[model samples]
Target: MTTLTRTLTDTQVVAKRNLLKIVRVPEILVAVLISPIMFVLLFAYVFGGAIDPGDGTSYREFLIPGIFAQTVVFGATFTGAGIAEDMQKGIIDRFRSLPMSQSAVLAGRTLSDVVYNVLSLLIMALTGLLVGWRVRGSLLDAAAAFGLLLVFAYAVSWIMALVGVLVPSVEVINNASFIVIMPLTFVSNAFVPLDSFPPALRVFVEWNPVSTLTQACRELFGNTNPAAPVSDAWSMQNPALYTLICVVVILVVFAPLAIARYRRTSR
Candidate 1:
């Protein structure tokens, strides 16, 4: 077989092994299933009232896409933590001693996590609907919104996976990596509009990738109130382009770095 085919075969093997492990350890799946629901409740009821959406729409409608972005970004931290755990338990060392493709192990972990992220997004979406959030866009637009979220989640997973391979301990990975992401999520237009912030903070919030993704999702979902600015720009124009650019930028920067780090660490 060709090198590319051999690599893909190994990736599939690793992915299957991880899937089996996920099945055996039901708690992992359960945690992924439950956390997003909890976030939907906590944010919608507790903080929703405090935030002004300014378009006569229920706060839940505005909050759903933001929650989706936040939850997926937060979920990525586990990618690193899981890798660290495997390394600590010598699972990674065992994989290294085998002749399997070097990049497959990390690729499998990331791919499995991407599947996990999709489930999480579905749970959040259902809960959002139950709480009176509706997608006003056409079916195609809704699908595109979801597709972009998944793409962004996958890109974030690779960056987190690199952290997993490099960090010495799961505890450190769990604590440190999320500190950066949490700020990235909250500082943006995820929970509220950027104009509401002070002039200094407004700049950071406007430029955040989370803000960009959430705005793009809002547009795709047909949240068009030109008077209702989610940021300096709320128009749906070019949302697909922006989402594509963000995905490409993230994949370009993080994917190779993650693979290189995994190969070196595994050796």
Candidate 2:
């Protein structure tokens, strides 16, 4: 077999092993599935009334995409925490002794976490539907929106992979990721209209990729209000393209770095 084929085969094996952990340890699946559901309910009923998407759009519809973006972004933490746990438990040492490609270890971990994110998104989608969120776009567009989310989430997993390989423990990985992610998700137009923000912060929010991701999903899902004040920022105006670019940039910068870090740390 070619080197690339061999690597892929190894990666699949490792990914299967990692995925099986979810079945063996059901709590991991439960936690991954529950958090998104809770977020859907909390934001849909508790805070949905106070927020408006303008143009008479249902707040629940506006809210669900933002929740989806946030959930998937937060789900990237699983990659970091899982890696940190493996490193702490000396699983990396065991993997190193195997005949498989070394890169498979990181690839497999990130790949498996995509399934976790998928499950999270599925549950959140169901909960959102129950709470009055509906897709106004065509089925193809909704599929594209979901595809964009998964693509972005996959890129984020590489970043967490680097953090996981570098961090001393799972707790540190979780804490470190939270500090960065919380601000990114909140400061964006995710939960509220960008018009509500102060000018200075609005500029950041307009350009924030998280904001663009949410905007892209809203646009693709047909959830945006015609009367809503839109950002003239290039990123916001071209959210889908901009988000795709961000995904490419992130993977280019972080994927190799994560792999290199894993190799060095495992040794």
Candidate 3:
């Protein structure tokens, strides 16, 4: 076999081995499974009545895409926590001593987490459907919307994994990651229209990645119209562009940092 082919084979083997560990410990899957459902239930019943979407759609429809964004963001915290646990247990140290590609360890963990994210989204989508959350867009648009969400989720996973490598304890990983993520989720348009916020708050909300992602998904699902004014010169124009930009920004900023931190920690 060619050297390139051999390298690819080795990475795949390492990735598969990590995935096998996930299969044996089903609780990891369970935690991923429960989070999205909890978000749907808590937000749909609790805060749905308080929010005015202005589009005349039921609150549930208006909120699903936002909840999808929020859930994926919340779900990413596990990436760091899991990695920290493995490191503390010496699993990562042992892997470092092996003749495997350095990238494979982080790649495997992040990719596996993406699979878990997909399953979580699927389950939440099914539950949302049962509760009357319908996508008004075409099937292609719905698929595109979901595809973007997964891409965003995967991008965020790298950042979270970097935190895992840098933090001294798994407990810190659990608390500190959410302290950053939860505020971003709440301060954005996820739970309310950005117009309702005061001017100072509105500026921050406009630039938030979670808001951009939610607006993109909402437009894709036809839950809200793109031509409608979110603010002056910001009408949710070009949702695909927004998703693309967020994904690119995240990958460009976090990918190298994650790799560098992993290499340093694994040493």
Candidate 4:
């Protein structure tokens, strides 16, 4: 078999192992499905009225995409934590003794988490609809929006996989990832208007990958702000393209780094 085929076959096995853990442990599903719903409720009812999303749109509409973006990015913590747990428990050593592809372990861990994110997205989409958020875009466009989210998420999962290999402690992964992810999500266009942000801060918010992801979703879902001035930044002007670029760059930079860490640290 070719190298690509060998890697893919081994990856499937690792992915299956990770997926089986989710099936055996019901609570993981509950927590993954519940938290996004809770975020929808808390933000929709509590802060919806407080945050104005311009004249034509409701805060609920604005909040849904932001929430989705935040949740997916936060989902990376699960990837990191899983890897760290495996390392802490010495499961990596056992995997190393096998003759499978070295890349399969990290590849499988990240790929399995894509399923987790997909489930979270579906649950969140249903919850958003129940709370009166609608997707006004064509079905194809909506699918593209969701595809962007999962793609970006899949790429970031590799970064977390590296962190897991390096850190090897579940508790530390959570704390360390939070310090990095929290700011990226909050300081972006997720929960608030870009106009309200000062010029200096707005620059960063406009270009932040998190913000572009949020913009791309809003445009695809037809939830954009009509009253606000049009953004001209390269990132905001062409969010879908920009988001694709970010995903590619993230994967290129992190995938090799993660695989190297897995090979070195797993042994």
Clashes of each: 0, 0, 0, 0
Tens digits of per-residue lDDT, candidate 4, 52-140, equal 96636889999999999999999999999999999898888888999889999899999999999999999999999999999999999
Better of 2 and 3 by TM-score: 2
Q: lDDT for every model?
A: 0.82, 0.90, 0.82, 0.91
List RMSD in Å for every model shown. Answer: 2.0, 1.1, 2.1, 1.2
- As for candidate 1, its clashing pairs are none
* lDDT of candidate 1 over 37-108, digit per residue (tens): 998999899988898777766788888989998888888887777778888889999998898888898888
Q: Candidate 3 on 80-162: residue-level lDDT in tens?
A: 88788888899889878887677777777777778778898999999888878888989898999999999999888988988
Kindly provide the TM-score of model 1 when superposed on the true structure, using C-alpha atoms.
Answer: 0.93
Tell me each candidate's TM-score. 0.93, 0.97, 0.92, 0.97
Task: State, as a TM-score between 0 and 1, how close model 2 is to the true structure.
Answer: 0.97
Instruction: Indicate whether candidate 2 or candidate 3 has the larger lDDT.
Output: 2
* Model 2: per-residue Cα lDDT over 177-266, one tens digit each: 988889989999889888889998999999888899999999999998867678889999999999999999999999899988877775
CA deviation > 4 Å runs, candidate 1: 230-239
lDDT (C-alpha) at residue 134 in model 1:
91
Off by over 4 Å in 4: none
